[model samples]
Target: MASLSFVNVCKTYKNGLTVVKDFNLDIKDREFLILVGPSGCGKSMTLRMIAGLEDITSGELWIDGQLMNMTSPQSRDLSMVFQSYALYPHLTVYQNMAFGLKVHKVPKDEIEKRVGRAAEILHISHLLDRKPSALSGGQKQRVAIGSVIVRQPKAYLMDEPLSNLDAKLRSQMRVELAKIHRELGATIIYVTHDQVEAMTLGTRIVVMNSGVIQQAASPNDIYENPVNKFVAGFIGSPSMNFFPVWVARRGEKICLEFGKNKLIANEICSKRLVEDGYVGRRVYLGIRPEDFHEEGPEEQKILFDVEMKEVLGAEILFHGRINREEICVRLSPNVKAEPGERLPVYVDMDRIKLFDMDTEQNIIYV
Candidate 1:
């Protein structure tokens, strides 16, 4: 419902500790923007700054074209949902959902209408008369979200609101939150350490690390074309595998060499390596777990000494050594494999990524 812009925002505490550095981002109206990283990466601090809960040490925060540096939390027209479902334990679901509206002295009929609509949207209409102690974890979370929805704020700020739920419930709520976003058309700024949540929920994801914005883009772009090694390693589930290899030229062909193994570089990678003068230099070779295949060209195959295996329903994860470097490979469950076995696996050369050894930046993308 509103656009938010952070222009060179930085937050430093009195102890001289800076958690967010030179942060700049523009959140579009009706956009589900996610701020995601490891703990202490300044994602929550950024969200708090937007809610006027934290003071901006420097730079500007503009909400819908108005400077809101000194605005109070209540005056900011933003609602925040925390990890802990901060519900009035003694109050019924209906009362908890209606509390904010009643505080503003909204008409009795209007409060009922808003609460009813929110309850229906959250699929918690049947539990309206129940108190917090009587509802399940998922139900209580829905009530917490329902409370915020009734406010009809300009944007919703969520700081890992689903983190408290169990794994199964968390999965269920992810779907619900996506549905709510579509129905309300509300602008939401969500902060989380869970990359899965960031990938599934956000229309755009901002990957941060140690106070800096690493990469901000659509989920597909960030996954397929990461700006650097940190973003690439952090966004994926199994994490991308990296190997330090020398870029070598065998006449017209370019290859990545590590230990006794070699992978022929694709045409694009070969040209970049040659033109960039990386031949015979060491760089990090990145490959996702899914990129390894059980079959391929004989020359492209490498020996994988499997040390461990994980059978995850539809797929199996082989953890072992390839070219003397530890790596993980995801394969269909239809394939049979066991520990202490040496298997030949092929890598998808076109999907491999090369990173500068010193800077750890993706060569092709950066």
Candidate 2:
């Protein structure tokens, strides 16, 4: 395993379009780091730069403390697994896994040993004699991974390697990846647009957008305390609900008003707003779908006209409107809900998030 670092790295096209801006990160040895974002968000561009497939407009790339800004991809001591399983259809699984070693003229015995070990680790030992055409999608993927495993490179770069699999197979491959990481202790850099994959597979995640790094932290930290509105909305399923709210101070108490409902701001939120001199200022109120409950005290309740109901097993997502703003509430499967009806939903005050209206930044969390 090896440590990787991107120091003030950047990528700009000849036409003057900058895709990655002053990118900086420190990847520890054996760390499984994930680059996650929406499409066209520079996640793939960053990976390409690291793999030496693209030129860096400026800055440095380091691997194990060696400067690799101008190093060729072949000399980078890294292996990349592409989104498509790039296996030779004519070769058997064992031959495909051993191709790289043979090209480098490694001893025949050594190649066989490495191929056998990788197949065993990936649990594909039974399919070694089968050609690529005879293998399933998952099996082909494993062969692609095994092809790199035999090289014993310093790090592994996987760009959406599980994207083409079916949903159930993708879920299975996630577990297999974690197992592979444990057994090999290989440093890995993974890129994907799937938030669930990012949350489950990455030891640390870097959230990116429009050529900028928004947040880089553990999955739990990013989920509970996103740095900005984009990170908050992107990380959660069904997305967090946002409402235009006005902050007003009444008799030494700070309160938030949305529509016809008002709730006292928690101590942390109140203190931040007060210090920022935001009394009577409009801000965005952020809350997760799951944080809205069907049962609570009347003081915490807010009424909304349910517009749509989506039934998901074990839970239901209720879509409603409040003061012309759409919001979704996740409730228990047992809760009775219907469209075109008014419902009193309670906000979990302890889990509330507040963001600045103009900046869209989390006030308390930041």
TM-score of each: 0.98, 0.97
Model 1 worst lDDT run, 10 consecutive residues: 297-306
Question: Which candidate number maximizes lDDT?
Answer: 1
Please give the CA lDDT of all the candidate structures.
Answer: 0.93, 0.92
Compute the lDDT of residue 35 as modeled in candidate 2.
97
In model 1, what lDDT does residue 266 have? 91
TM-score of model 1 vs. true structure? 0.98
Model 2, range 1-366, lDDT digits (tens) per residue? 899999999999999999999999999999999999999989999999989999899999999999998999988878889999889989999999998899888999999999999998889999999999999999999999999989888999999999999999899989989998988999999999999999999999999999889999999999999998899989989899999889998887898898799878878888999998888899989989999998887767899889999998989999999889999999999888699999889999888888888899888885
Name every residue pair that clashes in candidate 1: none
Candidate 1 lDDT, 314-359, residue by residue in tens: 8899999976788999988887878999978899998988998989
TM-score, model 2 to reference: 0.97
Segments of candidate 2 deviating more than 4 angstroms: none
The positional error of residue 100 in candidate 1, measured at the CA in angstroms, is 1.6
Candidate 1, 311: how far from true, in Å? 0.9
